[model samples]
Target: MSTLRTLFLSPRVTATGHALADAARRRGARVETLREWRVPEQQRRAEGSSLYAGPLFADAVARELGLGLLEAPQDWLARLPRELTLRDVEFGTIAEAWRLRRPAFVKPPNDKSFPARVYPDGSGLPGPDAVDGTEPVLVSDIVTFAVEFRLFLLNGEVRTASRYATRGALDVAPLERDPRRAEVLAFAERLAGTGLPSAVVVDVGLVDDAGWAVVEANAAWASGHYACDADAALDVVLHAARPEGEFGAADRRFLRPAPEVVRD
Candidate 1:
């Protein structure tokens, strides 16, 4: 069997990134780093243990490296507690949402293809030429979150979590025993049973008016750890993203599962 090799394409790994790499190394995986977006043919042929890329180049790099980065399901938020309030605008039908006119929060369902924010209306968005009509976008009713947390999940479990923000400020406090923690864990449990991706980042928040609600689900490989336990987060990242696989369409209700293993 070939030894596992982890690759990262970042000029400088952040503290969290370094921690993850260190964790992988501790687990006996050889870690490699490249400053370029493109992986050489020889490097790509090695036994890949894991891969992480910068946000700006993540999607493109993943495609070139054939990494499997699981994304959030389109209708996942609707299946959670805040479904009644959150809305979805399909790629080709966003004009209808714009017709609604009422103020609402808008963002791409998976990728950061476009900015996620409150748009006054369809007119507020960039012209049609700038927005891809094939990518689905989420337009939700605006709500206030008193606290927000990011949970790294694998095999229907919360491996590690962190309180990244409180109220509106950018905070990085460690998670503690609180009602919010319990609430988000329960939410994750329910989401796991719903046939979500094998590994993922489930973001939950304490809404000032709506109690605990889901904020969004992001790909673990591309998400920031904030104050999360580096070792634990690394575990989730390992399974969540891979060097190559063909996704199964029926594994998750909406989200796809990674392909079968590819050994060197």
Candidate 2:
């Protein structure tokens, strides 16, 4: 049997990473850890069933390790309900964003290059001194939601889901059957039919007055599981960024490794 290899960034290994490592082991996968960003040149190339890394290192690892990190297409936004999506514009400079005539929410689409917040207008945003005005900034119309949920999807199937927040507060609730479940599922199903990535995280929220709407789409590899099932979430994670038909014998490094030796 071939080995199912999974690599993670050792430096940024969080509780979520640990949980995934454990779950992968249970599924007969071999898990490997590395400092993805600064991998020694000699060790740059590796073979594995799957790989997960921070956005900064993900591309590099995927290239060198021969893994595929699934992702939504660039124009996926066009496939969503235009009414639910906030009007967004990409600016190369805060000064360029400052030219907006109306209020909106602003953020970097994929990174923390700039703060994501509501601004009265372009001029109301932080100046160039706060962040790199030359970096790309996404300015979008402001929208609000009463309840927000995160769904882990795999090949059009909603494998696991959880209520992540309510009224902007950190509220972890299970996404069980309810009055809005059917409607929510319908929306997700619509998105699945789109050209969006087969495996990804879809954040949906209820605006009450506006009904259900899409909050955003996120790459499953870098998203948090929230209160979703770890085992089920792991299933999504495995396929979220894996090569085709690469399964093999289980690597037991994480299953039953040597005990850590601590010095007093």
Candidate 3:
């Protein structure tokens, strides 16, 4: 009976955002889609120099979409707002960071962060200049994890959870251990203690064969859509909408609103 305005961000249509958009349409709510980065006309003209252009375009996209920006704080480079959450590992100094144990992880602290290439805890990945050596960088003890889990959060509540055995980019397998399963779910719950955005994914992994650790929180927009259950994932996402059939067609959907007209 009420109308709401929602904005979803993703480089491309993703499962989480798609479901949310579907729900919103069914509920008669308006939804808009935006990307993390949008290259400008002039910049794109250069052709071969778009590698470092993500941030520049992403900033523009944030303005166009009228939504708060997200970033991972692991590197001093992310340049996030102070009030935004900072990762524990994104410490300012390597001297200070030495306090952390080896075999932990060093990753970006925010959602928009491109995943940092992980380095072993004490393997001298950084070399002599590692800490005092270079500009501000994100570093953490490599997590000697026993298990990893990905949990979905819809409007601040847990929707569904899945366990993983990851060895690299594509080797993700469903977890087979009860303790690993139990730990991942539990970690997801703990992260909810901190306030998070409306639609997001809470990824948790283990550290040092001991306690469960926070991997990195991600926006449903940019992250993978469905790894565990597609329909269930959609249900949680579409909960905010009206009914399912209001949109023109379920398969080809458009949530991006028409541009406003000028009064002049």
Q: What is the C-alpha RMSD of each candidate to the true structure, in Å?
A: 4.8, 8.5, 11.6
Worst 10 residues of 1 by lDDT: 84-93
Better of 1 and 2 by lDDT: 1
Candidate 3 residue spans exceeding 4 A from truth: 1-58, 69-90, 93-105, 111-115, 119-137, 167-182, 230-264
Candidate 3 lDDT at 79 equals 33
Candidate lDDT values, in order: 0.67, 0.64, 0.43
lDDT value, residue 153 of candidate 3: 73
Clashing pairs in 2: 2-248, 2-249, 5-49
Candidate No. with top lDDT: 1
Q: Look at candidate 1 and give me any clashing residue pairs.
A: 246-259
Candidate 3 global TM-score: 0.49
Q: Report the C-alpha lDDT of model 2 over 1-264, residue by residue, as the tens digit.
A: 234555455467676787778888887766677753444555444545565555556644555554556655433553455654533434355668878788877765544455678877888776767865665566655667888889998878899888888899988866774456677777677665665565678888887676777776677777788778888887776666655334222211101111232333
Ranked by TM-score from best down, the candidates are: 1, 2, 3
**lDDT, candidate 1, 1-264, per-residue tens:** 123466564655677778788878887777777676556676663556466654555644555565666666765665554442233433334545556467777776666666788887767765567754445667777788888889988766888999888887887776764446677777666664664676788887877765666788888877888888888898777776665543455433333343333334
The better-scoring model by TM-score among 1 and 3 is 1
